[model samples]
Target: MTDTLLNHHDEGPTTAPPLLLGPSLGTSTALWDKVAPELSVTHRVIRWDLPGHGGSAADLIGPGATVADLARLVLALADSLGIDRFAYAGVSLGGAVGLQLAVHHPERLESLAVICSSAHFNGSKPWEERAETVRREGLAALADTANARWFTPGFTVPGLVEDHRTADPEAYAACCDALAAFDIRERLSSIGAPTLLIAGREDPATPPAHLREIADAVPGASLTEIAGASHLAPAERPEAVLAALRGHFDGYALRGMEVRRQVLGDEHVDRAQARQTPFTARFQDFISRYAWGEIWTDPTLARRERSVITLTALVAHGHYDELAMHVRAARRVGLTPEEIGAVLLQTAVYCGVPAANSAFAVAQRVLAEEDKTEG
Candidate 1:
């Protein structure tokens, strides 16, 4: 898009928190049409057609532009629009961009939700070759291949594939470059914002394995897998994906507000209420009532137990950052070293040896820290 082509498609009330949505590679913002309406119920949803797709200009940063650069551009767009901070969600290329933003410009985000994206697109040669083909012959050349990875056999009807394959070739190729250069495994630890990682069980491209890697890297990140869906989980199973996003973001929003209140005090929250920035104010109402008042306040589980459950789920699913958060929370909940070890050992069988190995190392470090503090 043009330097100033920050198109804003507002759907909800002005009082709602703005959700900046990034689209997957090879597809325009139209890919979010179904999900956006549901999200708009509580959020002022803003979807963008990245450079070279939809009405946005093509290749504004040229062919060599990395996904990080695209992230910077999106942040710039938010800045220009007076959005000091906002929640973000993305799929595929969009998810990669969201990852970069969460790591690099964390202060500019309240929460992040990534779907069908990986921190590292490793262990696959076919994807690389297909990316190369798109970079040369264009997206149409790999239409069949892309369809196979994006949707399940049943969902890959002729009409659906054709619709997905209609993306702009140049934009799709640029996205391929972004994907090829994307790798944020090491930087995931630096992401401070709460995050949700969603994967399609049937996603052949960025499969559950890749999603596990992302969850493992980003501290305290949550993961949810949608059964019987493909790479286009948001589209193929919009309800499941939307519910996950809504629930996770809602919880984050509530918890963050509560924490802010505790740390900053009620006077601060009241002052914030009076002079709240557009970005902060919009999320306060919905997040406080729904996220904190409803979900977080549920009496069925103690926060301590909930923390352990959340962490255990992440560990079992190979979400490292989330596991780390839970590890820290475990200490807070008075879980002994032996108990933490037991959790990791149990997770090893369910999540796999390699993941369990990493979890053990993290648990050991966290426990060592606890010992030092107690000393």
Candidate 2:
């Protein structure tokens, strides 16, 4: 293990907006090679290998390690790099980690985008069994099985197949453990950051049903499913994945900037810019233009209404970090705490009581903070 923290391999201008990327299970940062260049045109991209996978050290937290550990590690990586906040885009296990981060560390994320992922991975027994096999045998044993879910039948490329085959076996097993234990289905509604959920229509591993479950659980979560792609949507259908991420970040960045200006005022924005450190400056323009500009200026809905809708959606879907932010935004938009509670209670019936139960806890904390600030 390298004592030094992981560093991002940058493609474009160092000053562009930063996007920290998490790769799929069992693969290295190279998984993003084809997609990162296109995204790098406008954003500074960071692609890193997960611990015990790729170029990173081979120490596992054992089968007992939770997905939250991955989330915390990623966050630690960001902190080590001096990133206060940045956009996050993840695939499968990576996406699940992103969701957890958005819920638990809202202040550290500007936006989140998940592709070919699910909020829960509990019911898939065969998949778990196969993973255990890889843990014992190696990745080669599951080559055919992994390939089928990763790419569409008609579009198979020999090179891509080889890439999948050569992946680290222990890393793959570790990821399987991460996925098997993942059960954030009940907590999707509490994520407060703007989110984009992309799925492959033909994906068998994480079917469209699971995607719908995620969308429905996270309030205001926008979903787009690629018709021909399967589980490895990023690799099999890079163009679609790139376009969705670009559009999402563009929209989210715009909305966030507008809100910052409104709340912090123009002078504050300017003063913040004047005093901006290199680390913080990387995200300033991108956040202002995209998150605040596009999302905030859209005439389709008012900020307050959007806030309420977003909060309701997250609560219904179970994304707590984003849920917390929107709850705060709901207050800023004039929604009463009671109204927010109503949304959670209503979501309980539609999304389930477990989700609602967790959402209510986040709501209470958010409301309490608001009350303290006012008092």
Candidate 3:
């Protein structure tokens, strides 16, 4: 059974959070080639091939296969890799499988991103017809239309087209059978995982409306539409797709925490974390994701400049405790005691004498503590 699991490519550190990338019906792991490496920097990215699409055995799925069947195969692959729960992002049929996991196997999923997919694929007629066509004449005819169906006009990835051309006709038809039967709209509201929908603005197969429908139904789900892309957005517009997936996976939290540690020092952050209670956890997350992640991590202003501004703001608000913290942060960002004094003196002129007076007292105490430790 381990050998019978879907073929997959794994990247990134084994200790990092697991993220699985699923491919469209006729595509394979190659579909994520452009984006997975970058995502792997912060996540353990594992992209898999559909049965017979890439390296997997053609018999892994059969003619009457359902999206739920595919979801189970995905779980088998994760289990083989020692992963119990994972974030998932998939395109088209792949996305449908992700939805199946979120709805049924919620405990195995951390989050989901459904790209160029729908809860229900229009209806069964078109897919049924396509499946029959492939069973009779093979994938050549459909493969010829891959570029037009998958991307905007004049944009073609030859490798993807080749993947479509080479897919096992029986397996491709079975996948179509899965799509034809897939309709999870009634259960959309029950999905509890954090969900994101990425739609290709130019996709003719599963248009932005399809993604929007999922967004509207799934609680707390968000939608993003990518211009100049079609069904295979990750292949056609990888950078945009990468950005959306990264944001959905909370890449900001990882980047933000690194910045927070640098600005506040490990001792301060660790101490604050030690004191964090369940009641204050959400507020702490906000500070990390918003204050440190988005604003402080912005490169427009250097850390030193931000420290100065933060100090002034704290003085203006008469927040002595926060001011004391920033005064220490100021030194970490390379502000000399003299520079700190200069900024506080300017604050006295503008923020008022009393506010600056209080700020100085706090800064003096922090500096004295640091001197004692250093000496």
Candidate 4:
């Protein structure tokens, strides 16, 4: 648990919330290739390989292994990266591990997504048989069969097939062994994190019924079933998968940029966006997500009301640059110059005449510039 994990593939702003992407049994983190790029836009996407898959070494699995053991490895991976809390989405065995984390490490996960996974996995006998077959005949024994079960007919993935073909038999078998004793149906209701279950209609490996079981058990959980998709919905129907993911991580960014653009005007927002570089990216994301998304998007008060308060505070605090920006934004969101002048007049009484005087000067300059540009 203390040892640091290696070769974790990460994307997006470090300031964004951490999002863990897990793969099915025998598959590497490559399973999420189709879904990660779009999702990274709203999150710090962290994808890792299972023990013995891809760049990951099989050091965690052994006799009597369970999903709990795999879950601990996931936690250790997060800990090594200094991620205390994260949203998780996984496929098959990875989804089971997500469920395990939601059950045991509830506080550590912000949200849970179980894709093409099950609670009992049909009592593990199927898993044990698969494990024994791989142990005796090696990876090929399961690869040929698992490939078909993983994807619908007429859809073949060479890289995914190669992943199963090259995986260590023992490690792959150990993963199956972990599934042998896994069952958490009773613990479903105890999960507090928001949960989403995605099922593939054609996936005989773990169909809609399995995801339904999870949805019905977990409080406030929802289910989505994709037609014509087998176990690999993210790969088969990438757009649909991305849509579901965007919906799941919707709050991470909180739709703040839209409001910011609406309030500040497109030209102002375009300039702010153009100014972003690697050094300022995280700060920009922070302001956009929290300041714009959380605060600006709040419906408790209208944008105009918030604008008046913001303009007044900026003027009172002597933040002339910000006050100027809000003054323009206030005009954009429909506050007339007279209304803005009244707010500044009120600010003069409480925050002092000098502050209001300076604010008026800044506002006058911005308004004159706007008129000149229009003309």
Candidate 5:
């Protein structure tokens, strides 16, 4: 259905990889507040509200809406932002929407994480009854019981409860309708994206068993059960949730490290790892994940081609130290001494004689060291 898009909050660098965060039924983008910022450091995190739940208009969805409807709105949001593919993570109803996208719109997802959600939602009976009650009496009565249903004992998030209490009854009931009709059990095996299932160990609503069922069905899917957490794992146990999301979404980290070693050499990587402190660890991971895993691993350009471009950039920027290291890398990647000199010559033409002159000296020193080693 053609409608105004859902209300959303966009964070992090726009140029970073996109990650869409979806909220549970009664909650808004606020559900992700605790975890989104950390994820935003590596990704463009876009958190969206359910229809009528926050800033979104009630008319964005109507009664008898399906999870498919919510999924469409999410896709519409991504399209508007010019994101063709993204990693997705969601909580409860939001997780169900992620499942829908994984099953039907697999091409749009780089990865999927379903947190405290299930495929069938324990059938349609309970949701239908809940929908009927909300339609007749509104959300106040249900909101009063949300804390027990959502969190472990002696814990609560007041803002989320307030969101539940203030949600439009009609729209909330429509989300229930969507839940009532959603049953992707049969289609679980068809989901092709890399999938992760996070279960709140103490969650009464959708227990660990529910997430396990999904993990068993989805190919290559992994599951993580967070201790002391209930339905809203990201809120109750933000660190645990963040760790799982990073492990799943950054599956590239291992590959990136391998590529880094290949391009930078084992001695360099070993020294860097030995020198890594807490402060520099994240920066190193960014280099491996973004530079080697993504840009270098991409097959569109050969290693030799990348070396040429990298050398040119290093020369133009006059980063002599970096240029020296890459000169060694260029040799490792199969660039000959003559080819390296040719690249430095081109840099002299465009990058200026002085910068290229410095680059040539660095390259010459590196090449002389290599010759001595070979001798």
Candidate 6:
């Protein structure tokens, strides 16, 4: 028998930001072992078992449960854990839940990363047929075909094969029912969370193009491909997948503390963080989630371009204190003093000399102070 969805295990620091990891169909939380530890370094990682897999038995997902229902179950699991807002990463079926979470509950997600997954899974007949097979004969009925699609030719994961063999038939079939009816291609643009779509070049399951459609629909979403890898890219190309995931999630400040330190100098960020009080807690959360998570982490623009834009906007708006702070960060991010001068000079031509003058003064002083400290 399967345990309730509430039985999902939690990992990483108790104080860290929450991250949910969902597994592919017929797999368990054990699918994430290679990747979870790396993420847990800065996040409270939850390895979620798929319904009817591992400890979560088939009975938990009776008839009428869709991916949306599975998504709701994950949310309920979060609520049970006291995590109001969290980040998510998943593969295939797990990734489908991530998609539903992004589209339906944007406010609840800090960031979303989907690997070897698709917006539509291409067709419903195959899934429906698979669901029927499992219902009639059990998980063994579908393991051979599933195992083939999940890995590259001739390279097998015995553990995952074992996982497929052990999954509860009713639960596996129920999840297939969710996949068969799942189609959100038309609604992809509505997703607001930062998204990373990864695909395997050799994957016959949900090929690169399936992920590409999603990448095109979701604004600012990025697509990465792994050469020579199949459906289970996260398992097949573990290191590459981990690197891409870390960069994507970290950029959003899901581990915002470290990302903030990297972008804004540790001493300055530390001071601001230490200054937080009950009155300013919400404001702090806003900056961490929006500024760091949404804006700074955006993959559409290079960090240097983001810095240039921030410096330019600050100059235009006369946010002098923020201008000063960003001036320091701009330098750390590789904007030279001469380049900074060029921005102010350009600002003077259109934004007017007064705005430019104040920015010029701030940038010069900040840069000079750095020179003195280094000396």
> Residues 1-375, candidate 3, lDDT per residue (tens digit)?
345899899999897789999999899898999999988876789999999898888999999899999999999999999999999999999999999999999999999999999999999999999999999999998999898899898999999999999999999999999999999999999999999999999999998898999999999999999999999999999999998997899766778889999999999999999999999976787688668987899899999999999999999999898988898899999999999999999999999999988888999999999999999
TM of each candidate vs. truth: 0.65, 0.65, 0.73, 0.76, 0.92, 0.69
Of the two candidates 3 and 6, the one with more favorable lDDT, higher being better, is 3
RMSD of each: 19.0, 18.6, 12.2, 7.0, 2.3, 12.2
Best by TM-score: 5
Instruction: Say what the RMSD of model 4 is.
Output: 7.0
RMSD of 6: 12.2
lDDT of 6 by residue, 6-112 (tens): 34778888877788998998778777778888777657899888777877756778655699999998998888788999989999999999999999999899999
- Name the Cα RMSD for model 2: 18.6
How far in Å is the alpha carbon of 276 misplaced in model 4? 21
Model 1 residue 346 lDDT? 77
* Deviation (Å) of 198 in candidate 6: 0.6
Better of 2 and 6 by lDDT: 6
Colliding pairs, model 3: none
Model 5 alpha-carbon drift over 4 Å, by segment:
1-3, 251-255, 345-360
Put down candidate 1 lDDT per residue, 1-375, tens digits, no spaces.
245564446577665677988877666666787789978877778888777666666655556568887887788777766688899999988898999988888888999999998886763354556556766776665676767778888675454456446756665666666677778888998898989999999888789888888888788988899999898887789889988988876654666567545433466467758976778755676656555555556679876676567666887777776576568766665677787788778777777888889889888887788689789
lDDT (0 to 1) per candidate: 0.75, 0.76, 0.93, 0.86, 0.93, 0.85
Error of 5 at 197 (Å): 0.4
Between prediction 3 and prediction 4, which has the larger lDDT?
3
lDDT of 6: 0.85
Q: Name the lDDT of candidate 4.
A: 0.86
